[model samples]
Target: MSVRWSFSWEDEEWLATRTPPADNNLKLAIETLIVPFGRSWQAVDNYLEVWRNMELEHGAEYSVSTPSAAVERISRDTVEIGDLYDQFEDVRLPVDEFVTLLTDLSAAMRNQ
Candidate 1:
């Protein structure tokens, strides 16, 4: 199945203020997107890794994971912050807020 990102109106407004990112910067932007949106994956890399593994094993037989799945899994103890998996939909937030929130979460996770 195909996946698409979601952006709230506030997220769109916040994104509009920033300049377009280069192709290489897409990963960073995606990471920033998921932070405050309550996604469970630690970073975008985790999401990609999940997708990669799933592709290797199932060859698209199963649906991909998404931010909604992340949130649900986080709530249910199936996944934790900083873990990566496939099947995620894009969840958008302001870059500044996302960076700050993620930084705080990362520190907390490391300390725990």
Candidate 2:
């Protein structure tokens, strides 16, 4: 599954809504990470740098050898990673990758 990653740098208020007393973490993430690249490769690259540094606060962190699992993990962390519409809610234009995935999924479901 392809995942979309975005954090809007243009909107600072986005950070105030994450991780509990999330006054800083969430906003910083949105403003500096995804807003610039939107759903592009550069955007995901930025997130990967940060994600790799995270320790999850209460569990073990292990090396991820599988590309599929790594993508899933990143997608899960972005909340709306699997979403096709939200990338346009506050960010710039998105790539067609998400649109393609959703379309295929819809067709498959219809066929079922």
Candidate 3:
């Protein structure tokens, strides 16, 4: 089986998402995109910028927890908005797969 991004409703977590997130995995779905858009604007790279930066980041420098250090932690190929305090368990994806999610979604949205 493979995984894909999605905007969902009617889940056990739906009610919790309504009020606020206690920190959760950043799902790169349409609805999930709205979370970072509304809450993490500083970290939200524009769609084009996300792709542009991918060419710049060279190595896999990332963390499993929310980013708290004073480093340029954001990678061009990765969206490492670690631990958004909306839920538990950070969702980690391979760099290429992660970028594919953003690119594919971007294309789909453009077509619509």
Candidate 4:
């Protein structure tokens, strides 16, 4: 699946005022993005564990075409999502874009 991020007008205004935001503003942005990102990671890990258990219990009936592929996709997405937080120092997305990224990341995790 592919996710696209978009910015809202309010986000535009907020970002416009603070390309390189004050330390406090940056901290607030990080906090806002990280909490949900962490939650999504937890949820994805739980889901993968449950899926593995179901497959173990049910054999072929519960088998997927490629279980490793699913895991890899989730891992890749998670890493990419996590990178948003990790690389925040190098990038300054608008608030709306940041929010959109978080929302999209969460959706990707849940969909998995």
Most accurate candidate by TM-score: 3
Per-residue lDDT of model 4, residues 2-112, tens digit only = 324322224222111223334654444434433432435464344545545754565423322122111111221121112233434422433244434545444544554
Score residue 31 of candidate 1 by CA lDDT.
44
Please list the Cα RMSD from the true structure of every candidate, rounded to 1 decimal place.
Answer: 13.2, 14.5, 8.5, 14.5
Q: What does candidate 2 score in Cα RMSD to the true structure?
A: 14.5
Which is better, 1 or 4, measured by TM-score? Answer: 1
Q: Show how many residue pairs clash in every candidate, following the order shown.
A: 10, 7, 8, 0
Candidate 4: where are CA atoms >4 Å away? 1-3, 6-89
lDDT of each: 0.37, 0.31, 0.38, 0.36
Q: Quote model 1's TM-score.
A: 0.28
lDDT of 3: 0.38
- Per-candidate TM vs. native? 0.28, 0.22, 0.42, 0.27
Model 3 vs. true fold: TM: 0.42
Sorted on TM-score, best first, the list reads 3, 1, 4, 2
Write candidate 3's Cα lDDT for 2-103 as tens digits.
545432224322111211222343432224433433333233346436444534554445332223211123554454444344443434345565545545
State the weakest 10-residue window (summed lDDT) of model 1.
71-80
Sorting all predicted structures by lDDT, with the top scorer first, yields 3, 1, 4, 2
Residue-level lDDT tens digits of model 2 in 46-99: 344444554253123322221211212323222222222332222222224323
User: For this target, which candidate reaches the highest lDDT against the unseen true structure?
Assistant: 3
lDDT of 1: 0.37
